[model samples]
Target: MSATYGVPNLEHCIIIAVIHNDGTMHSIGVINLEEFDNAAAVEIFAGRSLDSEEFAIRVVAVADADHAAQGVFALDAITGAAERAGISLLNVIMTPKIAAGQHWTDLRTQEYGILPDPAMTAPAIAAIVDGFGPLPDAEEITRLFTEITPADTDHARTTQRDNPRFGRDTLHEVRKTIVEYLRTYDPDWADGGVIGADFAADERTRLLDNTAEGLAARIGVLVEVSGSARDALLGLAVIDIPTAARIYTHIANQLEGIHRAHMLAVAAVLYHVDGRPFHARDALYRCGLAVLGESGHLSETMPVIGRALLAAARANVETDTARRFLALGPIAARRFGIETPDYDLYPAE
Candidate 1:
C-alpha cells in the first residue's frame, strides 16, 4: 500500500477512481472508514509492492485548520498501510470543499450545481460530462448519481400532502371516503384488497399518463443520448398498475383536483416543505414538473401518489392512508407499484 498525510479530525474521506482491468476501466467511489481498509486489502490481495511499478494509489483529504495536522497524519497512516500491502501510492491531498457536518449537503450541492438547465434546447449532455468529469468509468458515474439522488420518500410524500389542495384535514376526509367507497363497492373486498385491485390498476394509470404529458408541456424538456443509451432506459418496467390504482383511490379520497393544475400544485407543495435544501428541492420540483409536463398526465403518479406516504413515516399516526402509502412503495405491491422516473430523465448535465 502507498502512503499520504492529512489532519486527524477530518470527519470523512471519499475515494474516487477508475480501475483498469482486462482493457476496460471501471469508475468507482468509496466512502466511510471501511473503504480505506478495503483498498488496503485489495492491494495485499494483488501481491504487488507499493514500491513496484505495478501498483498505484491516490488520496484526497478534506479538513479545516483545526484538524489539519491530524488529517495529514491519517493520510500517512492510510498510505503506509497500502505500502505494507504492496500497493503504490499516487496523488493524495485534501479536497477544497471539506468542512464540519458538511458531507451530505455539500455533496448534494456539488452534484446538483452542475446539472444542465432543463429548458436548454441544445443537448444538456455537456452537463453530464462536467458533473462526472472526476469519475473514470460509467459505473462510478452511475453510483455517484444514485448517491446524490433523493431517496427520502417520506419527505417527498409529506410535501405533497401539505399542499393546500390536500391539507391534513382534506387527506383525512379523502381517506374516509375511500374506505367507505371500497366497502360499498366491493362487498367481498376489505380496504386493503379493494385498494390492491380496483383502485390501483385502472385509475392510477390514467392519472399518471395525463400528469406526465402535462408536465412536459409546462417545461420544455428533452433527453439526449445515443440510441443505445435511450433504449437501455426506456420501458414500463418500474410501474405496478394495480398498486397505482389502489394508491390513487386513496389519494383521490385525500385531496381535491383530479386535474393537471392540482397535480402541479401538489408537486410544488411537496417541493417546498420536504426539508430538503433549496437545490434539492429545485431538482425534485423540476422532476415533478417534468413528469407532469412531459406525460401531460400522471403516467408515473409516484410524485403525487407519494404524498399519502407521509402518514406511514410518522410513528404515532398510522392511518389507513399511511398503510396504503407504505404498501404502495414496498415489494408486496409488486403488481401495483407506480412507475419510477427513468434515470435518464434526471437532470444529469
Candidate 2:
C-alpha cells in the first residue's frame, strides 16, 4: 500500500505495514506525512512507549510519485523517526511505480520496479481480509450487539425511564442487584439455555443509558477491574467464549460513544485474559465495525481497537492469531485525544 508523503507540502499517500513470517500482516494504515514529523511519527512507525523492549522494524517508504532520479525519496523525517524510536530503519525503497511493473529498488537489494498492483500486495490482502472482508458488515455487526429478537433492549431502556433509577432508593437497588449478581454469578453460564432470555434482557437493561444518568449504574457495576467480572469473564471465555462475546457485544450496542466503547473493552478482557487470542480478534474486529456503523454520534473507536491491539500484543500462546491484529495498535495510541491511553484487560488486575 503506497502512502502519500509530504515533501514540502505535497498531498500524497503512503502506507507502512509489516508482513510477519507467518504470512499475516498489520498496518498502522495510510499516514499523511504533513501531519507527522520526526517525534510524533514514531507512534506511526512504532508504539507510544516501549512495552518490554525496543521493537525491531524495517520500514520501506513507498516513494511518492517516483521520479526518474535513481534514488530520491523524502526520507529524512522517516530516518529521524527511527532514530528517536530506537528502531532499525532497515531500508528505504523507491519503486519505479506499480501496475504492470515488476522492478523496485530497496536500500538493501536495490531491486527496481516490482508488483502488479497494490491490491495484490501482502498488506493489501491482509487489510482487505482483516479490516473489511468476510467479517460481518458494519450494520450487521451493530445488530449482533443490539438485536432484541430474543430480548428487548428498548424495554430495558423503558424500564430505566419508568423506574426513575436515579432515585436514591433505586440506585441502591441497582447497586445491590449488580453486587449480588456478580458475587453469585455462575461464570460458566451453562444453565441449559433456559435462563438465557430472561437473563440477557436483565443484563442489557443495566447497560442502557437512554437518559444521561442511566449509564452511571452500568459503569459502576463493571468498571472496577477487581469486580467479579474478571473471574466471571475468564470462566465464561473458557466455558463458551462465543457466548461471552455475544453477551458483552449485545450489552455495548445499546450504548453510544464512550459508553459503547467501554462495554466493547469488556470483550477484550474476557477473551485475552485467558489467551483466547483468535476469539479476541474476531470479537474486537466486529466490535470495531459496530462502532463505525453507529448513527448520530461521532464515536471514538480507537480505544475499542486499541484494547484489541493490546490483547494481540500481549498474547503469549496464540502468536499467529494475535499477529492478525497487530496493525491496529498505533491507530489506537497515535490517533489524537479522542480516547484515553488507559486500557486494562485483566478485569481482576
Candidate 3:
C-alpha cells in the first residue's frame, strides 16, 4: 500500500509515500500540484510507473476533510493517481493536530498508524522524511520571518464573490483615480493630451489583433498605467489602494511573463502601502523581471537584469523578502538581460 500527504491550501506540494506489503515505508516523492486539483495529481501519477505492483494507497491530511476543499488536491485525483501508479487507493484520513498523535477517523473508514519513532511530527515530519537538514538556530529562524505580518484586516478578508468588483472594474477605478491625481497634481506627466482616459487604447488594439500572443502586451498596458499611478498613490492613504492590490494579485495569478510581473508590481505597491512588506518584496521580484520583459531588453542570459533584480532585493528593508528575491537573480540573469545602472548601488550578493 502507498500513502500520500496532502496539504489543501497554499502549501503547493503533496508527499507521496510508497509502502510495501512487508511494511517498509519510504516517502518517494514530493509533488508540486500547481493548480491544486485532482487532475494535477493525476498528471503527477501519469508521469510515474510503479512496475505493475499491486498497491493500496491512503492519503493523510493535516486538517479535517473540510479543510481539503479550500484548495487541496481533489480526492478523486488522489485515487486516480494511485490507480495509474499501479496501486489501489484505500482511503483518505485527516489529523487535526498532526503531531498530537491524533487523526480524524470520520474522514475515512481505514485508520493508518503514525510513523515510528525517530521521525519528526506531522508539520515537521514531512520535511524530515524528505531529507532536509536540521532546524536553523532560533536567531536565524526568527530572521527568516517577515517584519510586517498579515493582520487579517477587513480588506484582507474580502472575498471574490462578496463584492464582485475585482478585475476590470477595479482597474478602471484605479485608472480614474490616477487620472484625477495627475490632472490635479502633475500635469506635466500627462503631456496635456489625455489625462485619466484609456491611454492604452492603441496598445490594446494592437495586442487584440494578435490575441494568441498578446497576454504580455495586455499586462504591459495595465502595468504602465499602474506604474504611473504608483508614485501618485504613494502619499494617498485610502481603501482604494488595497482594493487595487487585491485585483492586481488576482490578475497576476491569471497571467504569466510580463503581465504577471507588472500586475505583481501594482500589487506590491499596494501591499507596501498597506504595510505588508513581505508580499511587496515577492511582487517586486517578479515585477523586476516583467519590467525587463516590457523594456524589450530580455535575453536568454542577461546578467544585467540579474544585477538589477539583486539591487531591488538589497534595497528592500525586509530581509527575508530580500533573500528570496536575490535567490531568483541567477534565474532572471539566465533568462533575460537589461542594464539599469541606476540600481547599481544595491548589488546582489
Candidate 4:
C-alpha cells in the first residue's frame, strides 16, 4: 500500500491512522481532507479490511486555529467510509503546529544520520503513535525511534565507526550484559543468527587484551555465525594472499569499522596461530554476513559478496595455477542458503 497521501491546498494535512491495540498503526493513508470527500475516502480504504477488536482508526490534523475547524470537517468526511467498513473511528485529534513540526523533523532521518526520504510518513506516524502510549522519556523515545527505523548500509557503516569502543571496565560490563541477554536466547535462532562482525570483533579484542598467553582459550571464540557466512568470505580469497593477510592484520590491529572487516582480522590471527587460514577466514566471513543481515544491508551487500564467492570458485576451478582451491563450491553456495548473484561477466561453464 502507498505510505503517503496529501493535497496541494494550503489549509491543513489530515493524518489517518488505523491503530491496533498492540500499538501498531495501520495507516488508512494521509490526505488533504478539504479535497477528501466520500468518493476519495472509499478509494483510499476500498477493500482494506481491519480487525475491529485489534484496530481503531484515528484522524489527526496538523493545523493552527485558523484552520482547525476545517481540519475536523475534513476528517469527518474522509472517515465516513471507514465507519461503514466496521473500522472503529476514534476521536479526531488536532495537533498544534509546533508539535507536528517537531515530530516531522524527527522522522526525516535515522539515528546514524542516514536519510530515508520520500517515504518518511511511517516514522512520523510512529512518533505520533508512541505519544499515545505510556510516553517514555525523551532519551528513551529517541533511542526507540532509532531502533525501529530500518538502517541502510551507510547507517551500518556510520554506526560501526561512530560507536566508541568501551574500555576494559566497559568491556566487562558489555560482556555481562550480553551474557544476561543470551540466557533467554532462543535456541531455535535461524542459522547465522548469533554472531555479528561488530560483536565478534569486540569480543576478540577483549580476549586478546586479557589473554597474554594466547587466543586458544574459549574466551577468544566469541559468537558463532549460523548461515552462509562462510560463502561471503570467498571474496577475500580471490585477493592475493599478501593483500588478504595485510587486510586481516589491519582489521585485527585497529578493530575496523564494519563487521566484515572484523572477521578479516579474526581470520588473520587464526591463520598465524591455528595454521587454518581458510577455516578462520570462513568463520569470520560468515560472521560478517550475519552482521550485514542484522544491519539490514544484506540484500544490498549480497551481490558484491556473493559474486566474489562464485568468482573465487570459478577462478580456482578453471585455472590450475590459482593459489586457493575451493573444493566445495556448489555445496558451499547451497549450504550458505542465499540467492547467489548473477555472474554476467564470468558465466558458469
User: What is the lDDT of every predicted structure here?
Assistant: 0.34, 0.43, 0.43, 0.40
Instruction: Name the best candidate (by TM-score).
Output: 2
Q: Give stretches of model 4 more than 4 Å off.
A: 1-11, 98-349
Better of 1 and 4 by TM-score: 4
lDDT of 3: 0.43
What does the lDDT come to for candidate 4? 0.40
Off by over 4 Å in 3: 1-13, 30-34, 52-57, 64-66, 70-73, 106-108, 112-349
Estimated TM-score per prediction?
0.28, 0.31, 0.30, 0.28
- For candidate 3, write residues 243-345 as lDDT tens digits: 4354345445555455455456545545544555545655666656655765656553223323344455576444343234333323332222211112122
Q: Residue by residue across 92-159, what tens digits does model 1's lDDT show?
A: 55542333222221221232112122223132234233321111333532232231111223343454
Could you give the candidate ranking by TM-score, starting with the highest?
2, 3, 4, 1
Comparing 3 and 4 on lDDT, the stronger one: 3
Local distance difference test, candidate 1: 0.34
Candidate 3 positional error at 57, Å: 4.2
Query: In model 2, what is the error at residue 210, expressed in angstroms?
Result: 20
Task: Supply the TM-score for candidate 2.
Answer: 0.31
